[model samples]
Target: MSVPLTVCISAGEPSGDVYAGMLARELLASEPGARIVGMGGREMADSGAELLIDIRDSSVLGLVEVARSLPAFLRKRRTLRDWIRDNRPHVLVTVDFPDFNLGLAAQARSLGVPVVYLIPPKAWAWRRRRGRIVAQVATRVLCLLPFAAGFYRDAGADVEFIGHPLVDTIDAYGLPDRRGAREALGLSDSGRVVGLLPGSRTRELGCLLPPMLDALDVVRESAPDAAAVVALSGSTSDASVAEVTAMATIRGARVVVGSTYEAIRASDAVIAASGTVTLECAIIGTPMVIAYRLSPLTYAVVRRLVRVEHSGLPNLLAGRRACPEYYQSDVSGRFLGSAVTELLVSDAARDSQSGAFSDMRAKLGPPGAMQRAAAIVAETARSWAHE
Candidate 1:
């Protein structure tokens, strides 16, 4: 009797879960007999993977949060390691969540399983020494960023540039027509709209949402006709959503849950927490002000370790400050409001950002990243499993 081809994927956060789902679909489509399973959320399960773990409420953003959640993380790690041992999957695919995924990769390697790391850690930006560790464990790396491929290659890791998955996501979403988007989200067409994007984690809601609302209040002061809309990320808890909704209501901002694309389209400008959402806004050609406030301890540690010139993805991809950024103490209502207000009221400001966005898109490579990554995973499985 022949053994069924097994691919185990581990994605520790919501964004990575979405990516994992896409990859799983591609893998199953190409090889219907392949068994896909591991740790992820609804997306992966819906994509036909039997998830051993559901990653809801497990995302932590910074040093303090990770320290608090260490025990839980350790538990999940142990469970996954056991699964890997029992299954002995042909290939173990690790998606982002570097701190967790990297250790898992090392374990799989010791067990003689070939490991393919998708969207590995950003060692070029911080913890450059970790690049060697990645090179040591990963049999192959599928990178989303062009620069990341170069970085991994230099680290002596086998790497493939599959381009970025967001390009495909946005292209499929289609460019939003402002009037139509406003109608869909029930925002008034007469006034300028500002979207507030806090982030996907519980910690982000506590640390960033209030400041975003404060910025919205500031926008309303300058342009009384302007309306505010807040976008809730997919991974937020029910309690956190309710709290955020109540907070937005107090500030007169309408809360929109899971309608991120619509909110981005409805807005003339946005105040967004620094992360993938900024990159999404840029791809959608929405002008934005990026704000971030890490826990003080995390900020202190990150400030010293981070080697990048820009914190926002748009700025990093554009190789310049395409979006205005305010971090830590500078992430104030006054600063964020001024930047967002300029995009809302000034044609030149909006035009400059939109123009820069086009350049960033060019740098992000073509679509079909999921297909390429899926092919890589299957090839890796065959190469290792047959041997």
Candidate 2:
């Protein structure tokens, strides 16, 4: 409603923080004086957003974990709602965290502000009816996944599928040669390098890292010359970092902090936790075995709710076994080590997975997705500001 349109962004996850930061930088490049504010992690603050809350470090991903964090979630919701009511930003941009964000959008709508949903809840994956409900809350939906548009469109929501921000993110790395990257990190340049990304949450590190390291140990026994790197993400706790580094170091793998693309780049094959990191592995054209472990009760509770064929995003987007997924019961050191070894030892196996990576990348949309997304948000937010 004014020349310097105020935009509020809510991004509570590490992946979302990366996107929010990229989007914020793009927005600032175009609208230098505009006020950008909201909830995110260090990356968003680094991009010049006035962080009202930093929930990225504390993001969780399990059925039981969500239940445990409900109190803090509620407080965050109330704070965001009160801020929207009082400050009344021209446009509200929500990045994922659908359970929390849809409510924030509802509050922004109640105050007559335009809402732009970025990487909104994937109702197609489960609870299909919520997609229809989301259609009514946000003014425009910017989808990063290719199939995401049809879901919102079918529900009669305004939606556009900009190319995934990941492409742009990865492109910035310039696709360095694997040996050169490994050498740059001071790792052995000849042997197989396995990158281990055990997710980015406290519970994820707790539940997944031990087993992932166990798998790394199994690999070390067979290919003693092989190298490994346990890559910690932005959300990892100081305790988790210490644990992962110590454990991985004992298994002959060094611990690297938070350079995901470089980690993937340096590795020949990866044993990664199932999540957005799987997509990062795929984007880097690395063969991977994806693993996820949840609390037994949480696994039992949400097992039936999952509607997709593949648990990993790379496999899910491929609509087939683009990469192997070992869930709670299926996850074992043997299976994970064998998968990584298969990719490392066999050219045929690696080639097949590489083919699927190409297919997955095609489905991921084009590069410069953040700039495109920022353009859409800017146009919508500033449309009638001068009227």
Candidate 3:
């Protein structure tokens, strides 16, 4: 009898954890006898990957946060490297978290283990030199975006555009009934609802959310019947919610945690921090304004490196501004409020935006991305064993 194939995986943030979990589930279903081990969070562990390290311990963002956690991160890295060296798994699959995952890929490559990268680094966006490093280390790169495949292919890496996992996950939830959703949340169906998604990261909330709240106050003045609800990330602490909640209540706003989709579906419009949530809004056919602010140093560094003209997924995918964007210095309460108010009043604007969103969703292709990615990994492992 052939020995069961062993695979190791690693992810460094909540988003990565969710994606890793989905991939792990698919792998187990496709290859029932396979053994999976990894450094990830609750989601991946729940999906049956043996957890070696919890992702929370290493999920810091920004230069300052990483600097403060450097010693501990280094220690964790040493432990993970040792585990990889000792176990010699048939394959090491990395999902996002490029900084840590790239180093691990290199180590696995040196040990003659194949490395598969999902959601490969955004080298086209920044640090182009890293593309060469990826080409040297990764045996295969499974990309979510079509452009990402071209970028890696040009860099001499074997890359495939496997369609986006969001297509599979988001559609499964289906669209929420707007009036029913409003009633469930105790919000009046007659009033206009504006969804506020600050972000999942503490640093993002601290820097970007206060300005968003201030902007909502301006929005309320223009549209007196408009009510705002902040969608709290599951990863954010109660203390963080408290700060935003106090501010929101002072301005007559509502706070909803854990169910971001319901909040988004109920909203007449959305004011979201620029990231995956923008993609979610597009998928749900919600019109939105995308806003983001980074630390001064990080913003400056990113300005020089990003090759793309837009940051929001809706904007990037459409190759046009499907929604208003406020970033870095442009992310002021006044600017954001003006944008949101415009979206609230213009039916033509919302219709046009929603149309673009539908088109983008179609471009994302069909569901079952996780299952497809897993099947590829399983086939590769089986082929390696034969050789």
Candidate 4:
């Protein structure tokens, strides 16, 4: 009998874990005997990837947060390095978490392991230098955005635009029914509804949720019949969820856990953090206002380094400001509230924003992105066995 195929994936955050989990399941389906193992959270493990380390506790954002977690990063790095040296997995895949994953890719390359980067950093948006660095490190780069693919290809990286995984995720899960979702959230059909998506990371919630809640208060004043629903990410802590629920309850808003898409489907519009969920709302055809804040120091540093004109994914994909975006000091409940109120009450505003969603969806390419990515990853690994 020949040795069974083995692939290792490294995903350091919740969104990356989700995409990595989908890819792991696809890989297992094609090669039943293949062993998929790596560092990630419940998502990857549920998909049959054996966990070498659970990354649930290490999902920090911004430079200051990452610096505080330096010891943990070092530990994870040592563990991954040892695994690659001993197991010599046919392919080592790194998903997002650019700072950690890119370094891991370099280490894997040194150990003679071919590295495939899935959802690599947005070097095209900021830190343009990282584009060339990634080209030098990874054997292959799978990009979600067409523009990112172009940028990486131009930078000399062997790249493929597998399309945005959100399209695949939505297709796989099936979009939630508006009526059913509203009923589940205990929202009335006649009232206007606004969904609140603070973000997936704890730091994101800490920085943004208060302003989002404040915005909900502002909306309630203008549209007394409007209902609010706070959709918490699955990665959020029980304590955080409880606190958020309490806050939402006091403000007369319902809070749901693990029902983000449901809340989006149930709402006329969403007030969201500037992240993947903004794109999710766009795909689901919900008009949204995007806002986010970072630690003051991190914001100051980011302001200098980020070259992109827009922060929201919807805007980035549209190549224009399809959704209203407020950052740092400008991200306030009063501003976000006014934007949500406009989208909720003004048909023209809502129609204009939702119209842009069609163009954004068109750019994400056809579905089956994860299938394409999985095929490439499996082929890259299996071909290495022949070599």
Candidate 5:
């Protein structure tokens, strides 16, 4: 029997680490002899990939944060590039982290390594020119969202819609019973529970947490029994956790930093920053109000460049307002509190929203997407090694 080929896969954030880990597991399951190695967080390392670097070091968000971390980022980039050049793997797979991933793809292409981009950058949303750059570097692009396939195809990239991995993950977990979830989170039955998901990035926490805590305080006055919980990203720092805890305590809200799913499942409503978590909430059938704020300069540039009407994934997927989104100047504590309160009090509204979320979930298609992605990567590697 022929030995399995080596595939290098890199993912530079918690979510990317998760998808990469799932993909690695699936690839190994299908081709037991296949070798997987690359940069990822602990989850991916635990799943079997030979860890080149921990993604935590490179997972900063926003222009300012990226700028601040430039030296460290450059050092890691050089190290990975050297590793890839020396190893010369059969295939290089990049999972999101577009800014960094795109450069890595370019390096792999220069080495004549076949590149498969998983969860290609959101060029369709803002930086449309990235499409052409991706087309030039990647042998193939596998997209999670249906619309992404068309965007990349039009931009001259070979693309496939593998459906979202979130669908498969959520399906496997199943929806938690609302009451059971509340009990698990130690939430009271007499009042509403609100989930606060600022985001996983340090910059996002700095921009989002204070306002969210302020909103929770306002919410408490109107509904004295109301409780708030913060979903802490595994990537968060002890300092950030302390900051969130102090703020939550001052507001009389509970803060939980590691288990994101439990917080979402237990909440009567969620106020989240726009990103993957919005889609997760929709798949879990949680009612949510999505909001986001960027650095003034970033927002100013993005506002003009971003072509989409909806910022949240659920809303964009539905091609309608599946959830309310507040951006930049529009995102205020009062507005956020009002949105959460509306969802909490209106059972009929929640039911209708839940039904819409279910429909959206159905559109996401079947489970095992990670396995499918893994199979594709392994097969591609095998074919290349023969050449």
Candidate 6:
């Protein structure tokens, strides 16, 4: 009997945790006997990946926040290294969290373990210099977007576009039926409805949700019958929920946790923060007005570094403003309210955005990306065994 190859995976942030959990699912499907150890949030652990540490509660936004996390990072790094020395896994799979993962990749490489980076750093967007470290450490870069293949390849890494994992995740559940979704969430089955996705991170809710509530007032003025619902993530704080609940009482919007997909399906449109949620909204054919705000320091630093013209992924995928996006100074209740109202009331505008979503969907590669990546990881592990 052959020994199973072990894979150590790490995903530090919320979005990465999602994809890492999906990867863990596929890895288990592909190699049932293989051991998968990871550091991530509930999703990965729920998928049965043994976690060394859970970064679900951890949120760091800017350089200042990153600096504060240095001690914890050092401890995590040391622990993973010690585990690597003793366990000697065949591969270290990193899912985003570039700052932490890149260093760990280097160490894993030094220890003669193959490193595979799933959703490697967006070095093309900023810090192109960091791609050098990814190239130096990782044996393979499994890129989620086709556009990134050339960028990572240019960085001198062995790169493959694994397609967006969302395709499969979205497909597995199938599209949400609006009537059913509305019923499930206890929302009205009729009239104009819009989703409010402040963001998955705490900092985002603090900066963004107030503006969204104010915007909802503007939306209500126009579409008096319009219903609004806020999708909540597991990491959302109780205080944030209390604030949203209070705001909802005054605004007549429902605040729902753990029903993001249903909320997206149940809505006529979504006012979303610029992140993975926008892509999720797009995949479901929902028209969204994307709004974003960062800490003054984080916004200042990010604006200077980000090379992309669009803040929303759908817009980025379209290479143009398929969905209207407001950032920093541009984010306003009046403006966001106007956009949301237009989408809810105007079929032509909503159809145009939905059509753009169809085009964007075609470019997102195919479904089953997690399983495909698992097969690749298994093959990579075998190659390491021979080496």
RMSD to the true structure for each prediction, in A, is 1.4, 1.7, 1.7, 1.3, 1.8, 1.6
lDDT of 6 by residue, 90-156 (tens): 8889999887888888888989999899998888777778788888898989998887787989989
- Candidate 5 TM-score, C-alpha based: 0.95
Cα TM-score per model: 0.97, 0.95, 0.95, 0.97, 0.95, 0.96
Error of 1 at 367 (Å): 1.5
TM-score of 6: 0.96
Which ranges in model 4 have alpha carbons more than 4 Å from their true place?
none
Best by lDDT: 4
**lDDT, candidate 3, 1-387, per-residue tens:** 177778898887877888899998888887758888888886898999898888753476765666677787677667777888998777889888887788888888888788889998889778898888899999888888877788999999988788889887777876559987787778998978888898877778788778888888789788877888888866667787888888889877899887788899999898899888898888888899999787788778878888888888888889998899999878888998988888899999899898898889877767777877887787767766667
Clashing pairs in 5: 232-257
Error of 6 at 239 (Å): 5.3
All models: lDDT? 0.88, 0.84, 0.83, 0.89, 0.83, 0.86
Report the error of model 2 at residue 341, Å. Answer: 1.6
Q: Taking the tens digit of each residue's C-alpha lDDT, what string does model 4 give over 227-293?
A: 8899988878888898888888988788999989989999999989888898889888999999978
Give Cα distance to truth, residue 48, candidate 2, Å: 0.5
On the 0 to 100 scale, the lDDT of residue 333 in model 2 is 80
For TM-score, candidate 5 versus 6, the one ahead is: 6
Pairs with backbone N, CA or C atoms under 3 Å apart (clashes), candidate 4: none
Error of 2 at 160 (Å): 0.3
Enumerate clash totals for all models, in the order shown.
0, 0, 0, 0, 1, 0
lDDT tens per residue, model 5, 193-246: 899999877778878877787777667767878888898877677887888888
Q: Positional deviation of 378 in candidate 3, in angstroms?
A: 1.2
lDDT of 2 by residue, 1-387 (tens): 346768899998887898899889999888868888999998899998899999755888866778888999989988888888899888899999887898889988888888899998878787788798789998899998877888899998999999788887787767668877787678877877888888878777777777777787678777888888888875567887887787777777788886667788999888888878888888888889999888998888767776777778888788889787898866888888888888888899999899999999999987889888888898887763543
